[model samples]
Target: MYGIYIYNSKNRNITIGTKEEKKFSLDIYQIYTHDPLEELLNEFREGQFSTTLTSKQKHMLLKMVRKNRPAFAIDEEPLGKIRGHDIELYLDVEIPYPPMLRRPPYPESLESRKESEKHINELLEMDVIRKIRHKEIV
Candidate 1:
Protein backbone atom coordinates (compact mmCIF):
# COMPACT_ATOMS: atom_id res chain seq x y z
CA MET A 1 0.00 0.00 0.00
CA TYR A 2 1.03 3.61 -0.66
CA GLY A 3 0.79 6.26 2.06
CA ILE A 4 1.37 10.02 2.23
CA TYR A 5 1.28 12.30 5.27
CA ILE A 6 1.58 16.05 5.66
CA TYR A 7 2.03 18.07 8.84
CA ASN A 8 1.64 21.74 9.73
CA SER A 9 3.78 22.94 12.64
CA LYS A 10 2.29 25.27 15.23
CA ASN A 11 3.42 26.10 18.77
CA ARG A 12 1.18 26.57 21.79
CA ASN A 13 1.03 25.92 25.55
CA ILE A 14 -1.46 23.46 27.07
CA THR A 15 -5.18 24.11 27.50
CA ILE A 16 -8.26 21.94 26.82
CA GLY A 17 -10.15 21.62 23.46
CA THR A 18 -8.73 23.95 20.82
CA LYS A 19 -6.92 23.25 17.48
CA GLU A 20 -3.55 24.23 19.01
CA GLU A 21 -1.86 21.61 21.18
CA LYS A 22 1.58 20.72 22.56
CA LYS A 23 0.75 17.03 22.17
CA PHE A 24 0.20 16.77 18.41
CA SER A 25 0.66 18.61 15.13
CA LEU A 26 -2.07 19.31 12.61
CA ASP A 27 -2.56 16.53 10.03
CA ILE A 28 -2.77 18.15 6.61
CA TYR A 29 -2.74 15.06 4.39
CA GLN A 30 -3.02 11.28 4.63
CA ILE A 31 -3.39 8.66 1.85
CA TYR A 32 -3.25 4.92 2.09
CA THR A 33 -4.42 1.89 0.09
CA HIS A 34 -5.11 -1.70 1.17
CA ASP A 35 -6.90 -3.16 -1.88
CA PRO A 36 -5.87 -4.17 -5.39
CA LEU A 37 -5.84 -1.29 -7.81
CA GLU A 38 -7.92 -1.94 -10.90
CA GLU A 39 -7.41 1.50 -12.47
CA LEU A 40 -4.68 3.56 -10.89
CA LEU A 41 -5.42 6.92 -12.51
CA ASN A 42 -9.13 7.02 -11.70
CA GLU A 43 -8.75 5.96 -8.05
CA PHE A 44 -6.15 8.63 -7.28
CA ARG A 45 -8.31 11.31 -8.87
CA GLU A 46 -11.40 10.55 -6.77
CA GLY A 47 -10.14 11.55 -3.30
CA GLN A 48 -10.46 14.99 -1.57
CA PHE A 49 -6.72 15.16 -0.91
CA SER A 50 -4.91 18.52 -1.06
CA THR A 51 -2.41 17.06 -3.53
CA THR A 52 -2.73 14.76 -6.55
CA LEU A 53 -0.57 12.17 -8.28
CA THR A 54 -0.10 11.80 -12.03
CA SER A 55 -0.68 8.46 -13.77
CA LYS A 56 3.08 8.00 -14.20
CA GLN A 57 3.65 8.66 -10.49
CA LYS A 58 0.85 6.24 -9.57
CA HIS A 59 2.42 3.52 -11.78
CA MET A 60 5.75 4.04 -10.02
CA LEU A 61 4.07 3.46 -6.64
CA LEU A 62 2.76 0.04 -7.71
CA LYS A 63 6.26 -0.94 -8.85
CA MET A 64 7.35 -0.98 -5.16
CA VAL A 65 5.15 -4.04 -4.50
CA ARG A 66 6.75 -6.00 -7.38
CA LYS A 67 10.32 -4.95 -6.55
CA ASN A 68 10.16 -5.42 -2.75
CA ARG A 69 8.34 -8.45 -1.38
CA PRO A 70 8.31 -9.17 2.35
CA ALA A 71 9.51 -12.37 3.98
CA PHE A 72 6.66 -14.55 5.23
CA ALA A 73 5.60 -14.56 8.89
CA ILE A 74 6.74 -18.20 9.06
CA ASP A 75 10.32 -16.90 8.58
CA GLU A 76 10.89 -16.34 12.30
CA GLU A 77 14.71 -16.31 12.12
CA PRO A 78 14.97 -12.67 11.07
CA LEU A 79 11.84 -11.45 12.88
CA GLY A 80 12.07 -12.79 16.40
CA LYS A 81 9.35 -11.76 18.87
CA ILE A 82 9.62 -8.44 20.78
CA ARG A 83 8.81 -9.40 24.37
CA GLY A 84 10.48 -6.89 26.71
CA HIS A 85 11.70 -8.24 30.06
CA ASP A 86 10.70 -5.01 31.83
CA ILE A 87 7.06 -5.33 30.84
CA GLU A 88 4.47 -7.93 31.83
CA LEU A 89 0.80 -8.58 31.26
CA TYR A 90 -1.53 -8.74 34.24
CA LEU A 91 -5.16 -9.87 34.29
CA ASP A 92 -7.47 -8.24 36.87
CA VAL A 93 -10.76 -9.97 37.50
CA GLU A 94 -13.08 -10.52 40.46
CA ILE A 95 -14.43 -13.97 39.80
CA PRO A 96 -16.53 -15.95 42.25
CA TYR A 97 -15.09 -19.24 41.01
CA PRO A 98 -12.22 -20.43 38.84
CA PRO A 99 -12.17 -19.86 35.11
CA MET A 100 -14.17 -22.52 33.20
CA LEU A 101 -12.48 -25.21 31.13
CA ARG A 102 -14.54 -25.00 27.96
CA ARG A 103 -14.15 -26.81 24.65
CA PRO A 104 -17.37 -25.44 23.18
CA PRO A 105 -17.09 -26.97 19.67
CA TYR A 106 -15.69 -26.37 16.20
CA PRO A 107 -17.81 -25.52 13.19
CA GLU A 108 -20.05 -28.36 11.97
CA SER A 109 -19.52 -27.76 8.22
CA LEU A 110 -17.12 -30.13 6.45
CA GLU A 111 -14.86 -27.38 5.06
CA SER A 112 -14.77 -25.54 8.39
CA ARG A 113 -14.03 -28.74 10.31
CA LYS A 114 -11.17 -29.51 7.91
CA GLU A 115 -9.73 -26.02 8.30
CA SER A 116 -9.93 -26.28 12.10
CA GLU A 117 -8.07 -29.60 12.07
CA LYS A 118 -5.43 -28.11 9.75
CA HIS A 119 -4.89 -25.18 12.13
CA ILE A 120 -4.41 -27.53 15.12
CA ASN A 121 -1.92 -29.64 13.18
CA GLU A 122 0.06 -26.56 12.10
CA LEU A 123 0.26 -25.26 15.68
CA LEU A 124 1.46 -28.67 16.90
CA GLU A 125 4.09 -28.82 14.15
CA MET A 126 5.35 -25.31 14.96
CA ASP A 127 5.54 -26.00 18.74
CA VAL A 128 3.48 -22.81 19.16
CA ILE A 129 1.24 -25.08 21.18
CA ARG A 130 2.89 -27.73 23.37
CA LYS A 131 2.50 -30.10 26.29
CA ILE A 132 3.54 -28.91 29.75
CA ARG A 133 3.31 -30.22 33.34
CA HIS A 134 1.03 -28.03 35.45
CA LYS A 135 0.62 -27.60 39.23
CA GLU A 136 -1.92 -25.68 41.30
CA ILE A 137 -1.41 -21.88 41.22
CA VAL A 138 -1.99 -21.05 44.85
Candidate 2:
Protein backbone atom coordinates (compact mmCIF):
# COMPACT_ATOMS: atom_id res chain seq x y z
CA MET A 1 0.00 0.00 0.00
CA TYR A 2 1.18 3.52 -0.87
CA GLY A 3 -0.22 6.78 0.49
CA ILE A 4 0.39 10.49 -0.01
CA TYR A 5 -1.08 13.39 1.92
CA ILE A 6 -1.09 17.03 0.92
CA TYR A 7 -2.08 19.75 3.39
CA ASN A 8 -3.49 23.07 2.29
CA SER A 9 -2.76 25.88 4.72
CA LYS A 10 -4.02 29.44 4.25
CA ASN A 11 -2.63 31.29 7.28
CA ARG A 12 -0.98 30.70 10.67
CA ASN A 13 -3.64 32.19 12.93
CA ILE A 14 -6.89 30.37 12.21
CA THR A 15 -10.10 30.87 14.14
CA ILE A 16 -12.70 28.21 15.07
CA GLY A 17 -16.14 27.93 13.32
CA THR A 18 -15.17 30.84 11.07
CA LYS A 19 -14.54 31.09 7.31
CA GLU A 20 -11.01 29.87 8.03
CA GLU A 21 -12.38 27.05 10.13
CA LYS A 22 -11.64 24.67 7.26
CA LYS A 23 -8.14 26.08 6.96
CA PHE A 24 -6.28 22.80 6.88
CA SER A 25 -7.81 20.78 4.12
CA LEU A 26 -6.00 17.52 3.47
CA ASP A 27 -5.80 15.53 0.25
CA ILE A 28 -4.98 11.87 0.68
CA TYR A 29 -4.20 9.51 -2.19
CA GLN A 30 -3.65 5.81 -1.64
CA ILE A 31 -2.97 2.79 -3.83
CA TYR A 32 -3.30 -0.77 -2.53
CA THR A 33 -1.53 -3.47 -4.55
CA HIS A 34 1.19 -6.13 -4.52
CA ASP A 35 2.77 -4.90 -7.75
CA PRO A 36 6.48 -4.08 -7.84
CA LEU A 37 7.76 -0.53 -7.35
CA GLU A 38 8.68 -0.18 -11.02
CA GLU A 39 5.14 -1.05 -12.07
CA LEU A 40 3.81 1.44 -9.56
CA LEU A 41 6.08 4.12 -10.97
CA ASN A 42 4.77 3.32 -14.44
CA GLU A 43 1.26 3.79 -13.08
CA PHE A 44 2.15 7.29 -11.91
CA ARG A 45 3.68 8.08 -15.29
CA GLU A 46 0.44 6.97 -16.91
CA GLY A 47 -1.36 9.80 -15.06
CA GLN A 48 -3.15 7.80 -12.36
CA PHE A 49 -3.70 11.01 -10.42
CA SER A 50 -3.16 13.58 -13.16
CA THR A 51 -6.38 15.46 -12.46
CA THR A 52 -6.04 15.99 -8.70
CA LEU A 53 -2.25 16.11 -8.21
CA THR A 54 0.35 18.34 -9.85
CA SER A 55 3.35 16.81 -11.61
CA LYS A 56 5.76 18.03 -8.92
CA GLN A 57 3.59 16.72 -6.10
CA LYS A 58 3.19 13.37 -7.85
CA HIS A 59 6.93 13.18 -8.44
CA MET A 60 7.65 13.87 -4.78
CA LEU A 61 5.06 11.31 -3.68
CA LEU A 62 6.53 8.65 -5.94
CA LYS A 63 10.04 9.59 -4.82
CA MET A 64 9.03 9.16 -1.17
CA VAL A 65 7.51 5.76 -1.91
CA ARG A 66 10.58 4.65 -3.85
CA LYS A 67 12.86 5.78 -1.02
CA ASN A 68 10.81 3.83 1.55
CA ARG A 69 9.65 0.94 -0.64
CA PRO A 70 10.85 -1.81 1.72
CA ALA A 71 8.46 -0.67 4.45
CA PHE A 72 5.46 -1.12 2.13
CA ALA A 73 6.02 -4.77 1.31
CA ILE A 74 3.62 -7.08 3.16
CA ASP A 75 3.07 -10.83 3.36
CA GLU A 76 0.34 -12.21 1.10
CA GLU A 77 -0.98 -14.54 3.79
CA PRO A 78 -3.96 -13.33 5.86
CA LEU A 79 -3.96 -13.53 9.64
CA GLY A 80 -6.67 -12.60 12.16
CA LYS A 81 -5.43 -10.01 14.67
CA ILE A 82 -6.14 -6.69 16.36
CA ARG A 83 -2.80 -4.88 15.97
CA GLY A 84 -2.48 -2.18 18.63
CA HIS A 85 -3.64 -3.22 22.13
CA ASP A 86 -5.71 -5.73 24.02
CA ILE A 87 -9.50 -5.36 23.71
CA GLU A 88 -11.78 -5.41 26.73
CA LEU A 89 -15.42 -6.45 26.70
CA TYR A 90 -17.80 -5.16 29.38
CA LEU A 91 -21.47 -5.97 29.86
CA ASP A 92 -23.44 -3.12 31.44
CA VAL A 93 -26.79 -4.27 32.65
CA GLU A 94 -29.14 -3.56 35.56
CA ILE A 95 -31.65 -6.39 35.09
CA PRO A 96 -31.36 -9.83 36.66
CA TYR A 97 -29.96 -12.79 34.65
CA PRO A 98 -32.46 -14.87 32.67
CA PRO A 99 -32.35 -18.47 31.45
CA MET A 100 -30.68 -18.85 28.06
CA LEU A 101 -30.84 -21.71 25.54
CA ARG A 102 -27.72 -23.26 24.06
CA ARG A 103 -27.39 -24.13 20.40
CA PRO A 104 -24.99 -26.43 18.50
CA PRO A 105 -22.25 -25.01 16.34
CA TYR A 106 -23.22 -24.00 12.83
CA PRO A 107 -22.62 -26.64 10.12
CA GLU A 108 -19.81 -25.87 7.67
CA SER A 109 -17.85 -27.61 4.91
CA LEU A 110 -14.52 -29.36 5.64
CA GLU A 111 -12.55 -26.62 3.89
CA SER A 112 -14.41 -23.90 5.80
CA ARG A 113 -13.80 -25.64 9.13
CA LYS A 114 -10.08 -25.96 8.32
CA GLU A 115 -9.89 -22.28 7.45
CA SER A 116 -11.60 -21.34 10.70
CA GLU A 117 -9.20 -23.51 12.71
CA LYS A 118 -6.23 -21.99 10.90
CA HIS A 119 -7.35 -18.44 11.79
CA ILE A 120 -8.02 -19.51 15.39
CA ASN A 121 -4.52 -20.98 15.64
CA GLU A 122 -3.01 -17.79 14.29
CA LEU A 123 -4.88 -15.71 16.86
CA LEU A 124 -3.80 -18.08 19.65
CA GLU A 125 -0.18 -17.87 18.53
CA MET A 126 -0.33 -14.08 18.66
CA ASP A 127 -1.85 -14.22 22.16
CA VAL A 128 -4.67 -11.96 20.94
CA ILE A 129 -7.30 -14.33 22.32
CA ARG A 130 -7.55 -17.57 24.29
CA LYS A 131 -9.49 -20.72 23.53
CA ILE A 132 -12.17 -21.88 25.95
CA ARG A 133 -13.04 -25.57 26.46
CA HIS A 134 -16.72 -25.94 27.34
CA LYS A 135 -18.55 -28.97 28.74
CA GLU A 136 -22.11 -29.35 27.51
CA ILE A 137 -24.79 -30.11 30.08
CA VAL A 138 -27.09 -32.93 28.95
Best by TM-score: 2
Query: Candidate 1 on 57-80: residue-level lDDT in tens?
Result: 557764553344232132443332
lDDT: worst 10-residue window of model 2: 73-82
**What's model 1's overall lDDT?**
0.48
Candidate 2 on 34-98: residue-level lDDT in tens? Answer: 75545657855643555788666766888886665444433432343434656677656434643
Which residue pairs of candidate 2 clash?
Answer: none
Tell me how candidate 2 scores on lDDT. Answer: 0.58
With candidate 2 superimposed using the best TM-score fit, by how many Å does residue 8's alpha carbon deviate from the native? 55
Those runs of model 2 whose alpha carbons end farther than 4 Å from true positions after fitting are 1-40, 43-47, 66-104, 119-138
